[model samples]
Target chain A: MTVRVLLADDEHLIRGALAALLALEDDLVVVAEAATGPEALAMARAHRPDVAVLDLQMPGADGVTVATSIRDELPSCRTMIVTSHGRPGHLKRALAAGVRGFLPKTVSAQRLAELIRTVHAGNRYVDPELAAEAIAAGDSPLTAREAEVLECAADGAPVAEIARRTSLSPGTVRNYLSSAAAKLGAENRHTAVRLARSKGWV
Target chain B: MTVRVLLADDEHLIRGALAALLALEDDLVVVAEAATGPEALAMARAHRPDVAVLDLQMPGADGVTVATSIRDELPSCRTMIVTSHGRPGHLKRALAAGVRGFLPKTVSAQRLAELIRTVHAGNRYVDPELAAEAIAAGDSPLTAREAEVLECAADGAPVAEIARRTSLSPGTVRNYLSSAAAKLGAENRHTAVRLARSKGWV
Candidate 1:
């Protein structure tokens, strides 16, 4: 039986080329394509594909968040995430969101097809190197809000800007940043951001 | 005569698929492929393709740097840059490096094929929106060393680490950082980083 799949990535070149390559496989067919997380979720709702292959970073939302939504809305549609940046935190997040497959953009087309089938069969598939790195990296000590604030601070935005972006008060943002710095044993928010980034935590 | 082309992108899937798709054209032939900027330069030296299509972001160096080298070493081979992130400063840098083409990764395969031909024919092509943005963004005020220091400081690393990374003394790093901040009218190194990033200067 052929596996119907939804492919979503922000890069039009990657998405189009990947669709063409996957079409060469006899047992796999791409049902739809999307260029963002929201579009991927919308396509999933419309097509009911057997598998949803999403890029980890997209405009509207991340692949993990989309996968979580798919899990809640379309239980039968197994989701997977592919990323050129296979960060440990991203891998952990995807697995937590019940993503059936986690692989790098460097994977061969044949291997990706096989993983798609594996995922369709209700089996989990993660790149072994990525999995090992995740184990070595350990879990992040920062809470969700702390991590989010750190990510906002990654661009070196001021506390007021971060607060505006997060829709939180400036005081709250400062508190989260301080707590994150403390948890990471950092002397300041800048150091905290650097530390979290090194661990793939933010 | 058919145009010989070299494809260089770190994303294996995108490169493989792009190579496969480009092979379908009658007047185009992919002579070699590489996954890094340095490797791209090596392949260009070996294959001497008429057109070298490179990704802007790669492991060893950037496409602009590679293009500059190719222009110096193999004057006959024209170069183009394809990027998912088409920053204004990057566009300016590529153009100054004597690159013949600048395009986003979202372009259609057929359009890319045409661009390869255009670049091979000694004509230039750039995405219009990117060009507009580049023009609007204006030139970066930072010098090469200042820009380098700002990029190093971007990760929130301490001055000592930035010095080690750049092979400069800590005082020199501090001087460059301060100069960059002053030029950008930023209060501190962190704010300077944010400003430079927004301007695509680093």
Candidate 2:
């Protein structure tokens, strides 16, 4: 039986090309395509594709949000997250949202189709490297205090100012900055802040 | 004309499955498969496939290294990076290394094959969403000094310790923390570090 598939991504060129690519597969049928998260969710509910390939970041709702909706509304239809961003946090969140497969856009076409087939077949699929990194990193790295301090640091705020805002002593704020820097393996607060922002931890 | 392809990734299941998937395509042939970067480079040189799909992080020479070698040796073969990790830094580096296409592993099997065809046809392919985020975030957000300070913080080093290590005054370290907080729009140093680490900016 041909596996019904749905494609969701905001890029016109990518979406069209992906549709064309999927169409080439004899056992894979492109049932629908959506450009945004809401459209993706709506299309999935309407078309009921056996599997949905979703990009994480979308126009209205994000992929995670859509995945949650799909799980609630169409429990049988599996969701495979297809995204360009491979942030560990994003992967963790995707898993938590009940996505059966997590693949990054950098994957080869052959692997992608295989993953889709695997996920559609009801087997879990995760990038081994990402799974390892996610396991190693665990949850958020920053302590509550450190995360607060780092957020303040990202804005170029002074320790004294951060201390005043967060009701911590200036010395305490400095300590938090020091701790955060240590956690990120950064040499200074500025570098720590940049690293945190990129990871979407903050 | 049949498009010759080379596969490089460590996972046996994925590597083998991908080979099988691509082999089904009448116009595509898997000429070589390698589990490591060094092997991939050697295979690419040996087979000289029309396209080379490489994983970013491998046991020995990683995807970027293989891409560089492929670009230098096989100018006719278009290089496409296929990795599970979607770190912007990796993507930027892959492009810089002369890879014509960047595909995340999450793409459908059909799309992956299509990308190979598209890229081999002299077109470029990248996850559009990633492309946007990369454009938005640009390159390293922190200055060299800030990165140094942040790395120190990641180690849980105290401000005095960081200052001592970096030869900066305590006041300078504090200043850097504040600047990072401001840039990251974080309320505290901890939050700044978390944000920076998430973005891989540090």
Interface RMSD of each: 1.8, 9.2
Cα lDDT of model 1 by residue, B1-202, tens digit: 9999999999888899999899989999999999998999999999999999999999999899999999999999999999988889899889999999999988989899999999888899999999999999899989999999999987778899999999999999999999999999987899898888877898
Query: Which 10-residue span in candidate 1 chain A carries the lowest summed lDDT?
Result: A191-200
- The pairs that clash in candidate 1 are none
Q: Compose the digit string of candidate 2's lDDT tens values, residues B98-127.
A: 888997766766788899999999999998
Q: State model 1's lDDT.
A: 0.92
Best by lDDT: 1
User: What are the Cα lDDT values of the candidates?
Assistant: 0.92, 0.81
The positional error of residue B74 in candidate 1, measured at the CA in angstroms, is 1.1
Off by over 4 Å in 2: A1-30, A34-36, A50-61, A72-202, B1-3, B7-28, B50-64, B71-202
